[model samples]
Target: MDWSTKRKLEYFGILVAAILLFVVLPFFIFIYKPPTCFDGKKNSDETGVDCGGSCRLLCRAEALDPILKWDPRIFRVSLGVYSLLAYVENPNVSAGVRSAPYIFRIYDKEGLLILERRGSTFIPRGKTFAVFDGNFSLEERIPAKATFEWGELVWSRTTVSGPEISITNKALMREETTPRVEATVENKSLEPIRDLELTALIFDSDGNAIASSRTFLEYLDKGGEAEVVFTWPQPFPTRAEVCAAPVDVTLVLDRSGSMDDLGANPPQPLTDVKNAAVYFVNLLHEKDQAAVVSFATEAASPIESVLGRNFEAVKRAIERIAIRETDIQHTNIADGLLKAKEELVSSRHASAASQVAILLTDGVATRPEKGGDPGYPETYAQQVANDMRQSRIALFTIGLGKNVNESFLRSIASSSEEFFLTPTAKELRGVYKKIAEKICTTRAAVIEIIPRIYPR
Candidate 1:
């Protein structure tokens, strides 16, 4: 209790502490350091190698890989310039990566790798974010396919919520010349949104993405709106000839004795002809009207009394067609042409629609019996075709077999190029599809609409 005794005891305690720091502690540390999360090894309370249990690196198995809502896509921005984009989905709640490395491989029609784009992006949390690379030039090569791959990913814990932006008043225009997609991007949140990137995708009526463009928004005040327009320097590209105008087409098919020359009961070329006609009908635009006009000894409307937008009905009518089994079964090309012209001029046909008649025959016109002239049927068919052509009816004539008079068929077509020659029944579908593309295929639209934002 005295001052001197207390001083002596204090000095002894100080000596013991110095020995532990300089000697005892060093001995224990030199022998072995206890397992820690920072050791880069799976030890201690960690679940996987240096991950979880107070580690910054998250366990890869516990994380969800981003989804590919669609494959990588390319859109032409100008003559040879293109924009590459893909939608990556990160659904992990309250988690994201600071930087994500990605690679996109663009392939041509032959499946050869034409271009490879590599970039890094911030993985926005719990949303479909876009990976975009602009100003990519493929010169004259057209991209037919693209593939995406992810690089080494290191996910960390974080929270991210994208800017509240809404797209409205979307309109697509100038698709035939230079494609344009305009839309208003409005910031819906009270806070101003900064560094926003917008993408517009043009979709065809069939919902297939045909085009895409990228734009940047540096900043937008809360409740502010900005009109963004996407323009492509070139008119949309199509693999086949397409009609931009509305169409009203009639399939004037021959259901005569020659069509069933194979004697298969259901028929050979006729059966194939029906299938081709149905394919053509199914390819028509939603507003387009199709009529089935079949002729043996005389023309008849297989659809009974209507030519409208009901393509399935028209297809059914074409399927129901069979070769006329009557004793006077004859190929009446003139009657078929007349019947098609009548159907095209019907009230069911839209006033603005382009009137087209696809005339297919497997044999020479044998009707309107030439008592004196063997060429009478051909002359009569050409006269009827001339009348229809003068009435503004475009004709596409198909000579389906060796028996068909190619010269007469060519004369029936509105133009020489409108004539198609099919050497076999199996080749009819391709011919029909080509014709359908001429009248029915729509312009390319954007592939998808995905907006990504960067807050920092």
Candidate 2:
């Protein structure tokens, strides 16, 4: 064959091949299936229907397209950890479709599949429809850009329902450290969440899913409380401030005759107690609250001092304690400690960092008038100390005079180490100074460290 004849024959073959490829390639490249609601959107005569088009994407076999339409795709979402949520619009026709099950899926930033779920609904006739509550973890190493796709939504002539789903995640701070988070889940729907499977996904600073927990429970009701707690799997880069409770302090003063003695030192023994108590009160932070109680024959009072933004008010209350004894009979240490504890525990701010009762005495408890009498000074101090302990109020005792019963004082304090037995009146001021230091040194939060391979 000649060169021109060969070229003409080759060109004819190329034209036929191009025509065939154009017809078949598009069929695979894009799907052009009829809208799920196509038939339903039309009239009885099968006309005037808002079938597949950009204007509206639904049509029904039975019902005609109403001027106004209801959006069939509806859903709600919740979170168990920090997560990302989104939605997508169906880009298909609008006929014979009542509702279509919206398949929700989560993908990592790298386009890896993480989770998927299909909502319940039948595609009905409408101009517009929407799918909601597409949720994924913020912990999933999200790439710069991520995408979402719905599963094949089918048209169903019968009724279909949607599933109740939720997504939760831990909050991440600027440093990308996992935040301490607590979650509560309640079954507010009419139906019970049977065999509910819940998992909490915790993320790291780099947006990676690091830790997870599966929670199991019998059942959750409308008003039920299911508390789930999660912490960072790795230690935070920097330590955060710990939250400590406030302090509840009750000052118990000695009002016996010996308390009236002037100390060899510049400040009298009683004055030292007053000075120490006032200084401690002055040191109280905005979070700390204090009260005063004094005893002579019996514990006479729990005088409430106004809560101090600063310590000035507390000092005023302490200095105002009456030097006059309620009764000149004898010291009733037990009555005083007990009365002080009762008042402290009943206080609104009782459950604080340091729950303390400070007992100051310049003399021993009243000696027993009768062997079996329960009102003896030793018996009263012991009984009161024991009773205060049962109430969980920690006691710090201050003994001022040489005659002060060291052993008896030990028994009244919550802990022997917390008790202070000053051998002479000269040491009373130092005792108060020490007490103030102890109260202020209390830590903000209860911290007990347990060694672990990796913290979670």
Candidate 3:
């Protein structure tokens, strides 16, 4: 009787085990899932929610930060209205964000916040793009500084591709007082592109971007081209009053014996300097007045307060400047600057317009006796530079040759960036052109509205 009961129990146990293995286990397996990257919970080796480690997209800490190529630039459109542009670059080739918030802060000259505008835009992957904000108006406040700041960005993995386009030709033209730009864009891509956005940035010769504008194209077939135009109802700050606003500029030339040393190719330092000076004279617009002061041991004006419109006279004066042959044929930079200041002050256009002095030197200030302090020409030059700064006159110093004291030149200029150091006299013309552009153009009102992007 006991063996029969035991056998029945064993058979019942085997039947229960088979049912659990075949039916119950399969049912549980059908409803179960393994941990994956897209799952709501971060169970794998992920650094953040569904990111880092095995995920295609990187975690915030692992992703590269966006590069700001340049600071935001604000262009005054009218008395109260303005336009703004910020150039930003994404360094990651495969990371992109659908939307990124940004802020443009406008500040007064005293660094007081006038107003701020906030907006959001998409950032193209691995490409530099300009964020344009336009039609910003203030009742009577004028912005002296504008700054751009980006908010927290949520980047996602994306495949980025775009139509290849090239700028063929571009020019800035003013119709009356309004500023306009005409440019040609050519599509070189094999595929057609639609809704193409084009941006135009106008930079002065000093590489400071003054204005920016944007245009759009509906469609562009492969290998096709389009003419794009950007215009503003208000004139640029440089051309606000056209040639009516006068600028009195004095040229301070170094006529030391060392000026004969030709470091430039073809070896003609004086000739090159004169040619560059003449070129600078020609660059000045009408209603601007210029004077040439040559110096060695002494400073003398060749073209004493000549009007900029009298181009021939200015050229003749520049060409006539010769190296001093006296026993004291040493650089007297202080004397040259003082003579230039006198010319600028005595000019009829001086009081009504901007005053600028551009001093080009090939050697150190040698004639310290002429500086009113023997053996302290640099200190005397610094004093003169300080006086020029106090007078609100912009001073630009161009240092030619390797021996030219860069530190002294920097001290003489209004700012370090305003000092031009050229390895050879060949680059003097280019440097002069940049200075000329800055002199002729009005100083841009720079207002840094926002701080830089902070690291997390």
Best by lDDT: 1
Per-residue lDDT tens digits of candidate 3, residues 164-274? 777756666673578787778788889877777777776653346666667777777899988888888876655322233568888888878887776433336877888
Task: Say what the RMSD of model 1 is.
Answer: 11.3
Off by over 4 Å in 1: 1-46, 54-57, 109-111, 140-142, 238-279, 285-320, 323-448
lDDT (CA) per prediction: 0.80, 0.53, 0.76
Q: What TM-score, to 2 decimals, does candidate 2 have?
A: 0.41
TM-score of each: 0.56, 0.41, 0.52
Superior candidate under lDDT, 2 versus 3: 3
The predicted structure with the larger TM-score, 2 or 3, is: 3
The root-mean-square deviation over C-alpha atoms between each candidate and the true structure, in angstroms, is: 11.3, 19.1, 17.2
Q: What stretches of model 2 exceed 4 Å from their correct place?
A: 1-243, 263-267, 302-311, 325-329, 352-354, 367-375, 424-430, 436-456
Residue runs of model 3 more than 4 Å from their true location after superposition: 1-31, 239-456
When 1 and 2 are scored with TM-score, the better candidate is: 1
